[model samples]
Target: MRNSPLHGLRVVEIGTMLAAPFATHILSQLGAEVIKVEPPAGDPTRSLVRGGPSGTFIAYSHGKKSACIDLSTPGGRAALHKLLAQSHALVHNLAPKAARKLGVGREECAALNPELVYCHIRGYAAGPQQDDLASNPVAEAATGVMEGNRINGRPSRLGPSYHDQFAGAYAVIGMLAALLQAKTGAADRHVEVGLYETGLHVAARDLVGVQLKTQLLGRAEREPHGEFAMPGYGAYLTADERWLYLLMLTDGHWLKFCQALDLPQAADPGLARLKDRKKAREQVEELVGRAIGALPFDAAVARLKAAGVGCTEVLPLERVLEAPQAQSPGKLREVAFRGLQFQVPEFPRHPDADDAPATLPPAALGQHTREVLEQAGLSAAECAALLDSGAVRAVDPAGFAWAPVRATS
Candidate 1:
């Protein structure tokens, strides 16, 4: 982190669940000092999976410090105000009303520190619809994306909590842009992002089609048994029953794909045009499938790559942990808890230390409460009082190093 870009910067995160936490986690990885303000009982996500230190919490909060501050109390608010006065950025994903009540609203915090990059993330954008409660699934259902992903005649959520993650990512973008603006002079410290609006942007292309009254083509309308928009451009089974995905959208891709698999159609000028190939979908898929099905998955991928055709074997999400591409150095970073370690892909890997070992693990609830409060300028007596009153909470400093998990059974 000494050589990292945001090494000396401080970011205060008042967040729970995914969106706000994820944004700060990325900043933590980028070398920002991220202090996650948790509630007295700790973030709910801490128990969302296997009880303590759940996977959801681990994935979203690596390398972050947790400080429990009860914003509902005057003592807590005073302490947070002191901390924000010296911070570079503050981010939260609470409801608009809840934020105002907590005194962490953009305006409130910005008044304390004008140059602070303040990010407010919520369910919906401003206006009459702003307060409607929404999380990932509700936002997706409100927008057209969920309907577009209908399966078996029922609208279904796409596997991941993509909307939450996307909102968090956009919030980071907004904050980084706002931070840059500060270097030029008086900066607009306020940045806002809404999950509902993020969903709108995710479905923007389809929205454009509707307004133009033009045909909107997408995988949702794919043919029965086809996983993508066109023949031979989807997941297929090989001789070993392993799934392989192919991407051949253009005329050149089609030509290369045919030659790669040694299909006789390579010599047919009549099938050169994409439109003609579409017209002959049934038989074309049959020939393509037969050729690919004759070879094992590895051989099929090799032949396709040799011809400059795009292809890959399809593995389930869990199998990605050991996938060669994912296992390669600089592709992932480690997160640990109770002496157990796991890895997650790191986006925009650290510049000077791509292969560096993980330096910090996710903190326990209120893990750094005492240390952070002291740094925030709270007197030891004040800190002790707040901790006693339950306005703040702190785990023993020794708890920083997680002990090995022991068998309970």
Candidate 2:
């Protein structure tokens, strides 16, 4: 973390929920000093996750400072303005009108600090439905992700905030690029990311293929390729009902697959070409399926891999954490926060890094209010007045600094 690219930089974040917060979380990991500005009532998520310090809140918010400022009040707005002037970047996930009201909109932030990289995250990009409110589920539904993820003819929303996470990543990318450009010349400091648009980008290939092929070429939509779209490329069940997926991309691969599985019937010259094998896809797939079904899962996986075949076990989602792949050395490390310890995965492999990068504990509401206002150069008297006037939320001494749960409990 001390050697990260964004080291020594400070970012001011104002928003609720996922998109905006997630962006700053990434920035924080990249070594930026992120100060999250929240309402006096605190981020809605503080009470959201089983009455929070919920897993979601702690995961995204740890390793940052919190200043519970009430944007509705004069003092709180003043505090944010001061912070913006002293920070390198400002981020918010509010609608345009809401941002304007809170004085954190693009124009407002740019006016405060022309060099500031201001990032605005929202539901949609410039569109007929630009002002429409959206969240993770809404973005998925609007971009056909839910429909694309259909099961038994029912469109299902993803379990995670996949689109929101992508939007957050995009925001970070835009902000970093803007900062880089600023170093060279006059640059557009305002960066924007929209959730619905991000969802479309994630499915760029499908969007282009599905729309262009059908609309311009007058071709029907292709049959759903269950896994890999080819006969030799899909999932098969083993004798113990464990699933494994295979990928045979070429005629050579088909030959290899045949030899690996020891299938004398499939070694004929008539089935050498992928096109020919695809024509007999049912027969080809069935042959491989029976061969695999004759052995236990561990044996089948080992045998296929030893033959240089591309394959992997279809581990159930619930058992993913138990998989050896996810537990490899340096993949995850134990971090304590919100009275619980979790094995969080690390990102950005750095050659110089000898240990997993360190992250601070999640801050309680206004945990750093007094500390940050002072750092922003506000006098003690001024901070006291704001706290007294309800411009800032009170803090809990015990919860402000997170501690791990005791083992005895």
Candidate 3:
């Protein structure tokens, strides 16, 4: 832990669902001590669909201490205040109304601890649509990801929840930048990250192409048909029934690719330039596809490598996971939870590391109520009283539902 970059810093995570929790999970991987505050019922994802802790919850909450507190109660709110007073950062994805209702709104937290970095992750940034609620799929549509990554002119959602993952990554980046600013004598700041904005950023190259081509080139990029306009810039299936993608971004690569694949027409002066090849795109694709498709996957990849053309097999996720590099300490990690061992993807080890340390086990809901509160300077008796009063809770497989609490006289 001492070798990790964020070793001494502490973070308090207050949220439901994936985005904000994932962001803090990344921070935890970097050695920040993260205390996850959940409603007494636990995050909805914990029991999504068929019930029991879901894989998504385990994946995102690994290495965090869970504290179950009903923020609607005075005792619960007081517990949060105590936790915030000693924490360096707070992360949440609640809507404006929900945030204020819980008293962890940006202004509210700022008043509690001005030096704290308050990171907010939301479906959208500030705008007329700021209040418009969206889930991962909605964000995918809103940011054009579903519409842009298409097959046969029909929009399709990608296999993974990319928008949520991107939003989480952006939140981590924003918080890091804020921490850097604070290191230079600037006050701690509020960092905002939105799923829609992250989607746009992730699809930057496509968006930039639209701007440049329509404004400058006087043409729109052709609707994609599971391939690029450039013959060598997309995937092709081999004779052995395996798929591989090829890339030849420069003239030099094009020449080498043609020679290596034994395509005679590439030498014709009529197909000398990129514009000329694009003009005969169908013909070029036919020639290139036939040349590569005639070979087995490995043979095709070998020839492309020898010719210095970039090529890779279009493998499924499980196959890719079996790659040697993916099994390295920095990429894949083993974690134990409830007597079961699970292999999880890990962030690259921080630059300050000398060895790969074991990752923290994922916490069960409200598993750390007493320990975390004790760290926040609560006596054992006070924590017990809070639990007895229905303000704080310990892990209960039966689960607890959150109800609005009436203030005591």
Measured by TM-score, the strongest candidate is 1
Tens-place lDDT per residue, model 2, 80-185, is 8887888999888988778889888787888988989989899987889888788999888887678767778888898888888899999999998998899899
Q: Give the per-residue lDDT of model 1 (tens digit) for 81-111.
A: 9889988999898988898898988778878
The alpha-carbon lDDT assigned to residue 82 of candidate 2 equals 82
Ranked by TM-score from best down, the candidates are: 1, 2, 3
TM-score of each: 0.90, 0.89, 0.89
Across residues 1-409, which tens digit of lDDT does each residue of candidate 3 receive?
A: 6877788889999978888888988898888988999997788877774455567777888888999999999999999999998899999989867888989988988988998999988878888878767778787787666876776777877867768878888899899999999989898589998777787788788778787889887887645554566756788899998988888666677788888878886588777778788888888778878887799998888887988888888888668878777776567778786656777887776545564435778777898988999999899999999999999998875453324356899
TM-score of 1: 0.90
Instruction: List the global CA lDDT of all models.
Output: 0.82, 0.81, 0.82
Error of 3 at 286 (Å): 1.5
